[model samples]
Target chain A: MSGTLNEARLMALYHNPSAASELDRAIAQDPAAAALVAEWRRQDAALGALYGPVGQEPVPARLRDIILQAETPANLPRSPWQIAAAAGILITFGASLGFGGSVLVARSGASPSLVADALRAHETYVVEVRHPVEVAGSDAQHLQAWLNKRVGMSFTPPILTDYGYNLLGGRIVPVDQGAAALLMYENAEGARITLYIAAEPGQGETAFRFDQEDGVQSVWWIDGGLGCAVTGDLPREALRAIGTEAYDQILPAET
Target chain B: MAVLDEIEAAIPALRRYAIALLRDRDAADDLVQDALERAVRRRADLRGEGKVLSWLFAILLNLVRDRHRHLTRSAHLVPIEAAADQGLPPAQDGSLALTEVHAAMGRLPLDQRAVLLLVALEGRSLAEAARALGVTEGTAASRLGRARAALRVATGRDRQTGTGGES
Candidate 1:
């Protein structure tokens, strides 16, 4: 056999050592092919020597956390009005901040027009194949920093990977009063979901309230000083599961 | 939960492939995390039980391609020279050849590097590597051959210096 063909056969044999008998016969016949195979084997060993230890190293804690937390059951349902009443009690104890009017409005469980605003933002962006957001999700740090600066609230975007959604980045949209941060996420199947967060000083903690408009489903709630909503064209239960996770991760603990 | 246990078992190998592919530990872990999260979320869609490793590798390769595309579009591609400087270990006696091979790998095109690492470092047959990469088996073998040849030249082990088997 020609040298080039022999090298090709030796290379194949080197990659698939399970076909060792062919390689052995070739090596016995052609010393040059044998040397080439030996060299390739050395290269393979070098590769293993360099990278095999990486696999042997201890898996990181965060990796372990991912597996352990993958299946945490969603939070139990709560009556929205009752949770609003509890929020009202909590807000009453705090020294009346100037923003109490909006807080009181939120407590009555009136669907904040913010839900409509969020849905509009979701509807507008989710249809765009390109430039879905002002900033792309790949530059997440800059996206968060930019949104935080523009929206006037310091917050990190919730990781929705557990729900099969990944951040597609976000943008700041003008709301009824001020700018709101609209963060978008998408699943492998191309379904899109969005979270809208705007500053609502002294809004207190309120349970999730579901809203549906023109085929869009949203669950909006107020926690601490942030009024947030998650909107998507998903079923109520699926949207709630994602909203609950986002709420838990984004909500600041009581101080 | 059972699938999760299987996924956990695959983490080390996934991390190894990521590290070999990206040559950055933090970036490697990040890629692996994305892959694991994806695998866990989509475990129900996985057909058959024995294909988890290849499935996870496929997920990781997709992420790597996505990341490369993003970096390219953003004009933030890290120079291979910089990557070699940052990724290589300190040279030691009897380890110079390994270090050279590692540096040369960084110089390789990402597709070639990926194929080489899958077949050589990961010990995947060319056909299995092709399946993971979503490419035809012939294309994968050719890429593997080109990758090995490039590495041979880059590491100064070309035919001129050593084996005179091929013209």
Candidate 2:
């Protein structure tokens, strides 16, 4: 019932002859249609002839190993952000572990774990003289302004004078659900503190948590739905004290 | 357990598809390796038990397309003859079918080439080819048409038929 097969339909039928019954009927009715069918069949057969059977080739053992390795938990390399989040998880749990609430559900609470994660993140990257913060504290005005805009509040760099910490700078870190702000500070003695801030965690979580991992101590809390964590090598008491002061200054309405 | 075993069994099929698509044993191996690596990495992402071959085929096609784009940009056409040594038989002067077929395939554009291999070589259905190529069934059919036509032209069969079916 056709003069010329539509290129598109011809293409479809060419790949799957079983579905081309109408075309086959048209071919049976017309000589030209019959020849087109025959020619197309030869082309298909020729294409099939191009490559010999491929089933015998060996799947390289190394390739199989690589794929299988990816399945194992240990093979999953923790990104810096994941590591930081883990620390935050610990900070949340650690605080809850100390304070004793929701003892059954380990890492479910929001503010505590989030704060904990940030503090842990701070501990990770604050000490490096190079790349301490994304935008250096040398440009304090710009750094503060940029972070203030991004973190959705006016930010005055928290002063650590009483704690012997001076502002270093800050950077941006991406988390699973949202963004994080990282602030770095260094003491005259070259000790460093990192502040990581993000949104609160799951419901019924701690307001404060202190944790230590890999020689770094972090204190984390939630204020106004924002999770904040302070990380350092300082004693847990000192870190907690620093966290409390920073939280008070950051969370309280500015006079 | 059955799904994993099925996929494990399909590895040989995947490698075969990849080999035909890439035309080089080592490169085909590399492509299969990357696909399997991804499959293992995101095992939780597997949709169902029986779709392993389709999944692997999709991954292999993506790799092939990516490499083809990269190679095309580099304009490197390392002839099939140069790459087809070792496993291939020495030209016995008779039965030029294999050589002609290889040359014909090497001349197809990537889309057409993928369709021909999936439908003709791998014996995948039009629907399966469409899924592997990430195209609609109509698009797959059209590509298959052009692929077969191109092969006919490349193999000199189109010339023997006279100018009646010529386009």
Docking class of 1: acceptable
Give lDDT tens digits, candidate 1, residues B45-85. Answer: 99888888989999999998888644323322434453344
- Native-referenced DockQ of model 2: 0.26
Name the regions of candidate 2 deviating beyond 4 angstroms. A1-4, A17-26, A64-255, B73-76, B82-96, B160-167
DockQ of predictions, in order shown: 0.31, 0.26
The alpha-carbon deviation from the true structure for residue A161 of candidate 1, after best TM-score superposition, in angstroms, is 42
Candidate 2, residues A56-170, lDDT tens digits: the string is 6544555544433332232242578656754776566467445433332254344444644564466446545556666877797898776654554444667777988888788
**Per-residue lDDT of model 1, residues A73-130, tens digit only:** 2112136853564356335433342364345346546546666567667766677686
Residue A183 lDDT in candidate 1: 94
Query: In model 2, how large is the Cα lDDT of residue A239?
Result: 83
- TM-score for the first chain of model 1? 0.56
Looking at model 2, residue B82 earns an lDDT score of: 34
Best by TM-score: 1
Clashing pairs in 1: none
Q: What is the TM-score of each candidate against the true structure?
A: 0.53, 0.48
